[model samples]
Target: MKKLFFLPILFLLFACNGNAQKKSSDKAEEKFEVTKTEQEWKEELTEAEFQVLRKAATERPYSSELNDITEAGVFVCAACGNELYRSEHKFDSGTGWPSFDRAIEGGVAYGSDSKLGYQRNEVHCARCGGHLGHVFDDGPRETTGKRHCINGVAMDFIPDDTK
Candidate 1:
């Protein structure tokens, strides 16, 4: 009898959380200027990239080549070529993902994520609305105090011009 009573409450809680995430995603998508069909995105991105960017799936940590890059460059959206973070802001968070203390102005947007049964700030391309990753408070305190934990699959590094 106790289990039965608690089951309905659990279901309602999870159900409401899912709907809230969906609505939040919808609102974020609506603000994006560059819209694409699912087929178009799939055709453009690789299977791994597609999973991370389109489906919000995370790539294996420390598996990204970008994790080792030390060149001064710009990190752009792999889906739309919008500059999101600069190399100067990049840091080794030791979490295996590319971590930036801050994102470029107007480059990315935040949305509430509850995929882990708790709220997280989701990071996505402002132009295309593709999922990049999540941001957390654990970062370099000298800077923004934000660990913009991003997926390398969602980014492309453009080397800086040595002029």
Candidate 2:
């Protein structure tokens, strides 16, 4: 009887083992269109941008001015100027990050991230393979129902010149 109780616990433990998690470096192994050496990237991007874009590190929430941006324009990758999210899709998620309902098609790539000890859909710039952010299912249901929670330091806002 005691063995039956331990069986479920053992199963849960094995299910959550580190081996089952996807390695974060898996995305790094893939080639991107705009490839640059670490030195080159370091020179072009600021410290905060390099850490988030190159190292896949998360920035402190609410630290980015992009979160409050409501103007019309597009957000592009800070590393390579790759077009990412359009202004029309941007929304306030109240999650302390710039949230968008969708990304420009073919502009971003998806990968599995288990760095948090759980599965998350990681977003990256397709042009440069720079880490952008994560996508979650919980978002505005009126639209795509996906929240692209991106790091502000990883992007730059280009306001519409016609406006």
List ranges where model 1 is wrong by over 4 Å: 1-29
- TM-scores of all models? 0.84, 0.85
lDDT of 1 by residue, 16-117 (tens): 865544654543536678888999999999999999998999999998999988999999999999999999999999999999999999999888778787
What tens digits encode model 2's per-residue C-alpha lDDT throughout 125-153?
99999999999999999999999999999
What lDDT, from 0 to 1, does candidate 2 have?
Answer: 0.92
Candidate 2 has a TM-score of 0.85
Candidate 2 wrongly placed segments (more than 4 Å)? 1-22
Candidate 2, residue 85: CA error in Å?
A: 0.5
> Candidate 2 at residue 17, lDDT?
72
lDDT for 94 (candidate 2): 91
